[model samples]
Target: MLPNGKTNLIALDLGIHGDPIKALERIVQIAKSGVDDHVVARELIALSDGRAETRPVLGMFLGGAGLADSILYCRNQIYPLGLSNGLSHFLTAIAVLVSLLFGIRARFLPPSSNPVRISLIRDGELAGRFSVLIVTTLEKLLLGTRTGESQRGNMKLMAVDQSLSALLRLGWASLFRRMGKTKMQGIHLEQGDTIRIEGDHSSVILDGELFEASEGHPIVLRSTQPVPFLRLAA
Candidate 1:
């Protein structure tokens, strides 16, 4: 039940380690309560549980400690909407490295006739929305480390490189197609920004772990409570 008013504020003690899906369900319930009640869920969020491929890649450009916080801060405050300059350049570097590695790895896989359409939205904006044909979609291929079907069970290290590479190619193609028609957008992450990935049922690799998600059940990513990260003069 929700409190009576134009806005309802509810706090849940989801525990130190809680399930995100359950929390999302609770928020959904509050949203559906009364037409007049406005629900806003606010709290401090930490970085993901463990380290991911992106971590090392980020650490390569930036530093390991507080890496996510650094990326979030930079992307939010410094970078622009398109092409991305300043700190957002890290994302471009990551994308390039990821694409190159994946292209090399792609030769080993079989080709497929049907391609899937994957839409990547950043901060409620279409950054890179594309439909590409390949043996396995980039998202799937990156998350491939999680499944035994990929025959890469012990292959833990290459997740970031492979995933980012495939994603870069896809996003680049999308950018070219969107050029002249609309403003070309690239993937940029920032603090307080929410990334919604809808369509195509699959898992996303974060901090070297697989987060299973499905179509319509989009995964929303946000960062809170900036930590002491990527400090150079330590």
Candidate 2:
């Protein structure tokens, strides 16, 4: 997608559809009861044809050191997995250790052209690339710069823009100048913001379905009013 459109979404949620008229009646009943916001939302019995920014910006899970996978994180996307997943974890540990000791980020990626912009408009483009670019009215993201923990269900659009969001390691420490949003590598989007990306032969995946972008036909993203969809707890 050029910005965030051309929909082919595949999400797994509870299959519960209720009558809108009855739903309205229940909503009014709930409003009179003055229940919690989450409770009120849960009581809502309708569906919303919502839109999401499906222009998949490389969404990677670094193996969980709180950053991607477990205590050590590959700020860069360095996944030298071994024979088995456990072995992969071991390899990850060794790689991180070696990288820190040698003061070298063992990463090599093609230079990006005119980094993608996640903004409200082309004129107000924000320069940066992110590992996790999330636009939602949910809890804060896990290991995020601001929240530092997984979302507890709140609201906001946050983006962790970077080809490699710095590691608090020896090598990265020496290159402090290269590790920050100040270099136009961060995000906090309000409503009406649009994410624009331009590249040769750009391909976008929406809800797992893929599509290609070409000249005169670009992908686009826009905001949507909150949908009255069912919220099933996991």
Candidate 3:
């Protein structure tokens, strides 16, 4: 049961049937409402119940964190394997930590021949640029796989442990570097930085759901707030 007197979850698939803009706006509204992280998690879980494959629930939590300092306070930070919900929180934690640690990062993936231009915008101006954005795309593409495809363009739940360990040991150090032939770019960004992707107006999958964009208009991604994601014992 949720804190909002709800026994069932709301079907709010942000990037799917719902509009990303409106969904973001709603999340912002919820953030402003001063709701507890547990409540937020429950609502998110309910919202993402049916579409486990897409993992939109994980995306919403991360996207909320990216917007502001929110949290997904869960009762079980770690649970038995039977209760594991696809390791979504753990996977998201790694992605968020990596994003925070690394600035404007993207990896070019194979199999897809097209190149996309991704820019990091700060205060309405270009701050960083990526000729190839592969990491997150590949992460979404390879979701639900038993194992991470490859270290080159794939990320797994173990990354969360890596990020946490790095944080505990290194106390905010820069560790991202350009690797491989693709020349993945990284630009250091301050808090509240916005990432804008402008390519041939192709559709993008953020977290899991697909977002459509036009060539003339760019899709803006922002994480003005850092969301605290709690990991349950599983």
Q: Looking at model 3, how many pairs of residues clash?
A: 17
* lDDT tens digits, residue span 115-210, model 1: 112222332333222222111111112211211122211111111112344456435544445312332233222222223433343334343223
Backbone clash numbers for all candidates listed: 6, 20, 17
Off by over 4 Å in 2: 1-114, 137-157, 163-195, 212-216, 232-234
After superposing candidate 1 on the true structure, give the runs of residues whose Cα lies further than 4 Å from its correct spot: 1-107, 110-123, 127-192, 230-234
For lDDT, the strongest prediction is: 2
- Per-residue C-alpha lDDT of model 3 across residues 60-127, encoded as one tens digit per residue: 22221121110122112322223443363464345445554554344311111123444534334332
lDDT of 2 by residue, 1-234 (tens): 011211101111222124445544555665676545423121111111113433323221111111122122322233343244445445555554454345454343222222344444533544443333443332222332232222232223344443333333212423443222233323333333344433334343323334343444444443333344332221
- Candidate 2: deviation at residue 63, Å? 18
Judged by whole-model lDDT over C-alpha atoms, candidate 2 comes out at 0.33
Candidate 2: residue 39 Cα off by (Å): 6.5
Count backbone clashes in candidate 2: 20
lDDT of 1 at 67: 25
Q: Where does candidate 3 stray beyond 4 Å?
A: 1-111, 122-192
Shift in Å, residue 82, candidate 3: 22
**Candidate 3 local distance difference test against the native:** 0.30
Clashing pairs in model 1, backbone N/Cα/C closer than 3 A: 51-207, 52-207, 52-208, 66-229, 98-165, 99-165
Q: Candidate 3: deviation at residue 51, Å?
A: 28
